[model samples]
Target: MNLRVEQRALAQSDQDDVVVLGPNPADTTFETTSTEGAYKILGVRPGLTISVFDMVIGADFAGRFATEPCVAIDFLFEAAGQGWLLDADGERLSSLPYRPGRIYIMAAPKGAVGFYDVPVGTRFKGMDIRVDTTLWQKLGAGDILSSLDEHHSLHIASGNGTWVGVLPVPPQLLAVARALFDSAMVENDDLAFEARALDIVHASINAMRSIQPAATIPPRDRRPLQRARDLMIAELSYPWALDGLAREIGLTQKRLQTGFKAMYGYSVYAFLQEQRLLEARRSIESGEVTVTQAAMNVGYGNPSHFSQLFLRRFGVQPSRLRPSETGKYQEAQAR
Candidate 1:
């Protein structure tokens, strides 16, 4: 899921709290200036690297962050057994491990972010990495880049920070033992260039593994709720008014409404709307239709209606719900 995060720092008088990014209530671009605080977010991810395997192996990271000049401090962090901390001249000062339940923070000097080229080969798997630590903390620290499984995570507290480099991994062992060809082998290798590459790959995999699984509540046995849901999903050929669906399912509209709420955790109408919006997103992402066409195909006679629903469901407008857009939406949902 792709995430479009917009943050506005609160005034100094008020304890600063970064506003969560969501559907805006008024006519305001995310770029609008707010004296309240600095704003930074991941606007999009266009798959800068081509192949899935390449993304997994090389672990190329692309993102942005904002900082407060005076308050921010420059620091570098690396993982030593899951904990990460500031790397002060090759020595670990803090232990910021991969805690599953809590978010850890790292900060960098204002306006400084380190950029590096990570060559992830095809052997790495993106879904295997798990870094549940909130990306917001990472953003606050400056841009973060590292591998998933291996503790070789890297952090730049700001633009002023220097890299401690990718975690230790072994590359030369590839030719020695087939068993040493895994991500662990790479991470455990000599603490050099080849080893660093393996660490990057490991970090990426760990990150992929970190995301929570999709919600899987038991399906409702309630007939009307099930029937209404199935109909809405199966046939999106026409406008789906709530009354018709309730009637078709052989239940009073009220029963249908309450049953759906009890079972799906959303009202029947809302569930149906989500269904149509999801379909429209799929259509737009596949390049099978233009934004306008996607709206119409999903039974939204007016494009504005489609955009609003899309924004509500995925936190972005339908106009931006194409392939790259969909990926960002999906990634954000994972967070």
Candidate 2:
């Protein structure tokens, strides 16, 4: 993959409470080697302005829910980078990987960001996009949509502002964004790529708005289609059989394949493969998981096959992306 950055391996002993900022007084690259009971914040840029970019990762020690005390919103641009939520509503929260290309704007008072504390070794990477208020309102209507409250130590009051920057993306979406970005990086077509990426971004936002009522589309009307889709999404490992899923869903294999393709823009197998590859990508990005282990976790019994799939999905070999093995020129520089 064309990952622009790589972070140092996060230590297990790292705390889960406080966040670290800046390698030096003026440096924006924040680093923390421990997380025994605190949180950490890494900034790629030094000065605070209305606009900026960032790459961030977070890990929780107590559990997944331990991150609830933190509040930060990530913005993933179409350009393959994401921005971290730094100071929203006067408080700072650790950054984590969010869905790529999806617009998310959150504002909270202090303690709103506490939910971001993830387990040790968890890492998230993306570009940050920020804008001033004038530009934000132009994108869409601003409104107060949601609010969250929890432990006395953490509290958040949020409102949906005009999406200030780009949004977050899961690895599945990142694969698409990476492909688009690589093509742009190749032809030196920044303008074209940005436009296309923005179009995709708009489509995704519209899709987010297009939440159809499940009641309107009953299980009976789309039984076979939903069944295949559900099975493919639910089971990514251990060799999925078309006939088996079809039988379970009460449809012939041909019907299952055809219906799934017609409804979801992808064959069932292709969707499942993409999903598995996305999971593997996220696991490797976390740095705690090795390439071989990530491959197995995503259902590739053979490392070679996994590598091939990974390359096809992300345009990079799995070995090259893992944080454990370091030999490449760029990797050495990151350290």
Candidate 3:
């Protein structure tokens, strides 16, 4: 393990310390300590590295990493504040809102600098993995790397180029992350660690490939679609028709349908249905409304039909999510 510490002024007569640990690929166990918290890199394999960090900041903090030539995937499991990354020229690359279920992929060449900042007293928990391109080639995944290079927008500065983007973290990928974090508690489970790490790497690559390129709408054409989406979300109970919506948005029906499908990977009605079910689910889970009421709130007049669609989408009946009222009713009956 390689360790380095840097100190910077926080206030008058006060300083904040930041420490980073770089472990060898062959090392099975790696750990680091700082004033705020402890960090661990549990599973280290050739061509891949996995790390978990839990820290509370004492002051405004920023750190930079000089990364090797590789592709890095970062999953933010829990965070209480905001953060951003800077490119080699000290320009901000992107706004990274630190929230649960956020993931980012970075394809960087040698000597790339990664800058991160978080405000004081913010708690952060995350895991990151880095895989070298040569190792990917040796594993017969050269095509995956090539595809990322082709599809990703490159950020070139000072003769270095990096491709980076935020990805949607699906439930399947979250399950893998949970398993990996749990595995850290078991001692001497090298094989298990290795298997979980490989699972994450493969899942990341698959997620990248599954991204629908055609669904990416150009910036200038996005405002009307966003307005349409917002309107749908805001008025869940409103009876919506494609032609009416197109006229309201000053678009033809065909253009509206085509743009909705191309931008969201779903038709307008399909997206509306998804949003209705999701809102109904939230209402039921909150226990403030009955299943029928929740259904009706989302424009479903037939309770039976709503229940069927809800079960199909969420794999459970809406009533199952509602708070139990049986005990109170039983008490009243006995009295």
By lDDT, the best candidate is 3
Query: For residues 1-335, could you state the per-residue lDDT of candidate 3 as single tens digits?
Result: 23222212112212232112232322232223222754565425555666666666655345554567777777866565544445657776654445444566777645356555566666666777777767666756566545443223221112246666556445456657766766653344656767777888888777766654443655444556656865786688999999888888777788788877886666999989987887787566546688899999989999999999988987777777765566232223443
Point out the worst 10-residue segment of candidate 1 by lDDT. 45-54
lDDT of each residue in 6-73, candidate 2, tens digit only: 22211321433222221111122323323221121222111111112232233312211111211123
Candidate achieving higher TM-score, 1 or 3 = 3
TM-score: the better of candidates 1 and 2: 2
Point out the higher-scoring one by TM-score: 2 or 3. 3
lDDT of 1 by residue, 242-271 (tens): 678777888777777766676555676676
Predicted model with the maximum TM-score: 3
Clashes of 1: 49
Summed backbone clashes in each candidate are 49, 51, 0
- Can you give the lDDT of residue 266 in candidate 2? 63
Query: Candidates ranked by TM-score, best first?
Result: 3, 2, 1
Per-candidate local distance difference test: 0.37, 0.42, 0.61
- Candidate 2 ranges with C-alpha deviation above 4 Å: 1-203, 206-224, 324-335
Q: Supply the global lDDT for candidate 2.
A: 0.42
